[model samples]
Target: MFNSLQDKLDKALQNIQGRGKISEINVAETVKEIRRALVDADVNFKVAKDLTKRVQDKALGQNVLTSITPGQLMTKIVHDELVDLMGGHQEGINLSAKPSIILIAGLQGSGKTTFSGKLANFLKKKKNKNPLLVACDVYRPAAIDQLKVLGSQIGVPVYTEQENLNPVQIAEHAIEHAKQNQQDVIIIDTAGRLAIDEQMMNEIRNVHQFVKPSETLFVVDSMTGQDAVNTAKSFNDVLDYNGVVLTKLDGDTRGGAALTIRTVVEKPIKFISTGEKMDTLEIFYPERMADRILGMGDVVSLVEKAQEQFDEEEAKKLHKKIAKNEFGFDDFLKQIQQIKKMGNMKDLLGMLPGVGKAIKDVDINDDAFKHIEAIIQSMTPEERRKPSLINISRKQRIAKGAGRKLEDINALMKQFEQMGKMMKMMQGPQGKQLMNMMSKGMPGMGGGFPGMGK
Candidate 1:
């Protein structure tokens, strides 16, 4: 998402990397370039200026007149400033009340309802809360149906009063329903207009007063850039939202809203919705985000995602299979499914140090593996288990069955053979020695790539 900004900043910092000392003139030139990068990324003018000013001051103040690389030192300074720009620390939701009401407020097309469902799923899985998603957007029956579908997907109940036109009454009744059903968390999805108007603003304010929510979140589309910041200011004027939820971050967004919203609205960004999946929502961590912006990756978050889907028993079985040269197509398919569950392919790869910048310009479609999956699925049980048994005739049949070319089948088989060899080698005694060497040669590579740590 910060692809352009990262490139520009990298170039700006490169100018100082070879310097033996940090000079005021050189730092000023680098800071000017950084400021230009921020401005071009759609960051607010005042914010970009103030951020560069702070970074420059810090770099100059911390100057030791030694041989420390000015580029790395200044990178840290800019990273810290970026974190402070986006709310220095993570702010969690307030779910203290027995039936905590989280009022959702945003304009249309801001992904308000989607974030509501994702929030419910997150709370249900991570917070152990019985969340009831209330559909209070009486104007759009589609929104009510959408919420119901999402609730069904997440195994959460949806509270809807189809006959009621008043949102305040609907939310109030939903609170009562939550009490009856023992739902500890209540998320109300209110109506939104194409743009902010007095009628819509007053309606949301009334609903806010009636529900007396523990938290009010203003959802915004990050793709809107500066308009997202302006809209947030307007909503904050009336709703005084407790936090912001930036959605559609997975799109081709410059990510200016994430950098500028908190400074403008004086609200914490509690959550960020990456993709459309219910599992795509994540708590906004400023330092980790700053890490990503500086091309350092977010290895901590990457490990957490892996642990969420890692099965100890399955790993042991896979290890045994690898040791015995019995790792078959079934095992490979299982691994693929687990990786798919980790989130978007590009997003997952982006978590690795240096991978994001390497593949930023590549068109990473979510369905990139579909053809490979189809080819694997078309293989017979015996053929999948015993790849060496497949001859040219079998390849032709499988290619036709998968609707792929004969070359594709041959390529897959070749890749599988190479992978089997690698697995066998990795399980051998020599592989253990090599692993020990690597473990001692470089640290943190086992958990994540090197150079990701501060």
Candidate 2:
């Protein structure tokens, strides 16, 4: 994600470290380094120059407080400037109209179809709206099929007319279908081109005219860097899009498009697509992004993701099991599954405060639990329920069945034992007191036992 740019910015700020105040020489060095970093990240030279100038002007004008070091003060100033450059506040999509229409427009391979399905899933699960995905990319039969496949995966109905060649007609007919079917939202996925062509622009314009969408989003591939910004400008020139969608942010983007697109097009980035998964869509927040860019983890977003995936009813049931000393391998496997559903392992861990910077260079694979899951699946129901009964011979058999080594099975057993002991401790008086304290401090930790406090 912007690892290179982050490193460069960190080094730039280090120039003023241990200094008593922001001196002219130090400010010049810092601003120059900052400008160089931006240019290296594929940002436009003019934009980088202008932004650094503003940052320098602000840095020199402010009175330096005696308590803070020059580096810390400068970092704060730069962070603020970055946020301002990226649209100071978060902007939400307008879904006020009944069957609110959202038209997706972008270049081909910009992830428009995938984003449309993700948006439908987000609206259905997060906003409690019945969304129908409309496939208007008639030029490519495969595109329509892709949308249909994604729609099926997310359990959302997709509206498409195979015989319809005109996207405007398809969108209009889809809207009429949504009204009749009581679908609360209609997301029309239109066709796109490999580049900015006149025919493609006119087709999208026709769809926009007919649908009159509450939100028209221009999706762009962040990996394209400056090209992404240029394409965004071109799209906005024709359609005047309401917002931007930056896709593939989980890839090695140089941070150019994210930093320059908002300033270039004057449109807030409404959503960011971190991965191809249906649940990978996230609302863009300028302050949080600045924190991430500065190597500070985004704890608020992490907590919100945890809350979204936390199941109250399931937690209650799990609490009863823990109280009965019945926390078994099955329960442990289920917990791992729930965590996997939250997001990628490194992404989830990086969201914790202080963890992102600590593990910046470490590689954390999302498939870390693959062997453990295989081992658990190899166990019989009785063995999973009563893991204590498994002897060395049984462990060998399980390991052989799971295609793993004996030591791996033993390690898993040790972890399970530790988890069981922790659950039992949570059933005691001291654990109850700890639970009460944590519940008072954490809003989502207000249940009976350890597992219950999701």
Candidate 3:
């Protein structure tokens, strides 16, 4: 999301990398460029000024660390400032209240309803809470049905009063329903107007008071830039929300709202959502985000995501198969499923240290694995388990069955054979040594393209 901003900041820091020593003039010049970058990224003018000024101060005072170059010192200073700017600590939702109520507020099209569903799924799966989603957005057509569909998908129960259009009554009554139904948490989705209308604000404020929520969250569209910050301020003034949720961050390349919202509203961002998938919501971590912004890569987050999809028992079984050279298309398909669950294909690749900036201009399709999966599925069960039997005739049959070309089938076979060889290598002495070396290898390799050296 911090694409252009990262490029500019990286260039600014690189400007002094050749210097033998740190100087005030060079630091000032770098700071000026950073400020310009922040402004161009849609950050509030005053916030950009203040951020760069603080960075300048920190950079000037870093001269005592003489062992480090100016570029490295400035990078450290900027990283620390970014962490501070984005709420130094990660904050979680408040769930202390019995049948804890979480009221979601935001403008229409801000993804408030969808976020409620994702939050319900997260709490139910991760936090071990029985959550009830309250469909309180009665004014919007199909809003109730939308919540119902989301609940059905996640296996969570949704509360709705189809005839009642009053959100306050619906919210208040939903709490009682949750208590009787043994639902430990209640997430109320309020109606959002196209613009901040007086009636809309008053209705939400009333609902907030009636529900007396344990925590209130203001959902914002991150792509809206400065307008998001301004909307957050208005909502904070009325709702006094406990935290913020920045939605559609994957579509937002500027990401100025994420950088500036916390400072503007003085609220911690509890969650950031990317794409429409319910599993794409993530807890906001300031330091990890800062790492991503500076092209340092978020290895920690990437590892955490991988850990989420890792199955210990399955791993042991897969290891045995690999050692025996019995891994086949079925196993390959299982691995693909786990990887798909991690997130979008492109976003997953971008998590690698050097690859994020390197592939910024590349169009890595999310459905790139679909055709490969189809070809594999077209093969007979025995042929899949024993790819050695798939001769030219079989390949042509499978290609016609899968509605793909002979060349595509040939490519898949070649790749699958190469993967089989790789698995065998991993069980050998040399491959084991290479794996160990990679365990201690250069962690964040900066990826480059043909014309990217500039």
Candidate 4:
């Protein structure tokens, strides 16, 4: 994410970090570096200057206590200012109305249609709302089909009037359909229009007026940088949307749109779409974002993601298996699946405090478990249930079956044995002690990673 900006900010804070107290000279130098870093990240020059000035003033005004260093205080000040810069608190969608209407608007290629599907899934899963997705993009070819595909993926019904070219009429009809179907939420995916297109803009306005949505979100591609902010302003001027949605945020290393859009559009960032996955949508939290941008990680969000994919019953069963020394490749494969459901590998790792910077340059592929999965899948039922049965001949057979080298099988077997030993130890009387020791030695790594044992 904002890896470059985070590194720069860390360096900037280092200027006053080791100092006894905040001094004007050191504060000035640090603030200057901070401003440069912000500008380099594509943040608005004025916004960057205004934020750094506030940080400097706060730093100079503070009297450092013996408990905290100047660097810690300075980092705290900057984090707070950054939070304020991006909307101080999270803003949630208003779904109080019976079948609350949410209008999605944005420029073409802004991931509007995909976000609509994701939003529907989020509401269906998180908000416990029965959402009906209305595809209102009459102009774009296959736009309806695209929405239908997404709707099927999320198991949400998409209301589309293919024969009816009029979006307003389709939306009205979709509302009636939602009422009849007992749907409590209607997300109208409007056509993607350019700010300069008066006719298209007017069309979206008409739909907005007709629907009177409880939440009108303006989606923008965050990787567009300042242009995303400017486009948001243009849309806000016309529709005055309830909030903004930043899509493709995972690819945004500079984070200009996330930092500047709220201040420019005067709307809270309601959601952030990090990837193409329907479950990748997250409620925009300024504090959490500021934490991530400053290399502090977002442990809370990470835990939430894990919880979403966690199966309590399955955990209990796995614990029993571990205690019995019966944890096998099949159980390991299921764990990998659950982790994959949590989110992208790199993104999941980046949520740990101090891990983001460490893995900034590392390519932690989403399909990192591909080979392991293949190997596990190639094993017979007996082999999966009892990996100890896979002798040298079995290893060679499995290797050929999985299209892998014999050494790869050997490596996996060795690692799996080590993991089994660790699990057994953790399930024993000294489990808690072992966990504490591991945590102290490697914070955020109390549970060793899958396929990561030596």
**Using Cα atoms with residue i matched to residue i, what is each candidate's TM-score against the true structure?**
0.91, 0.91, 0.93, 0.93
Candidate 2 versus the native: TM-score? 0.91
Q: What lDDT is obtained when candidate 2 is compared to the true structure?
A: 0.88
Candidate scoring better on TM-score of 1 and 4? 4
**Candidate 2: 10-residue stretch with minimal lDDT:** 445-454
Instruction: List ranges where model 2 is wrong by over 4 Å.
Output: 18-22, 65-67, 426-454
Model 2 misses residue 282 by how many Å? 0.5
lDDT (tens digit, per residue) of candidate 3 on 1-454? 7888889888888887767766678778888988998899898899989999888777667562364666877888889988998999899899998979999999999999999999999999789999999999988868888999999999999999988988888887888888898999999999998889789889988998888899999999998999999999999999999999999988855988999999999999999998888898899999989988888888888898999899999999999988888888889999988988999876776677867877877887778789988998999999888888999999999999889999999988888888889888988898988788777884763355333323
Better of 2 and 4 by TM-score: 4
Question: Considering summed lDDT, which 10 consecutive residues are worst modelled in model 3?
Answer: 445-454
Worst 10 residues of 4 by lDDT: 445-454
Choose 1 or 2, whichever is better by lDDT.
1
Tell me the tens digit of each residue's lDDT in model 1 across 45-91. Answer: 99999999998888888882353666778888999999999999999
Which candidate should be chosen as best, given TM-score against the real structure? 4
Q: Score each candidate by Cα lDDT.
A: 0.89, 0.88, 0.88, 0.89
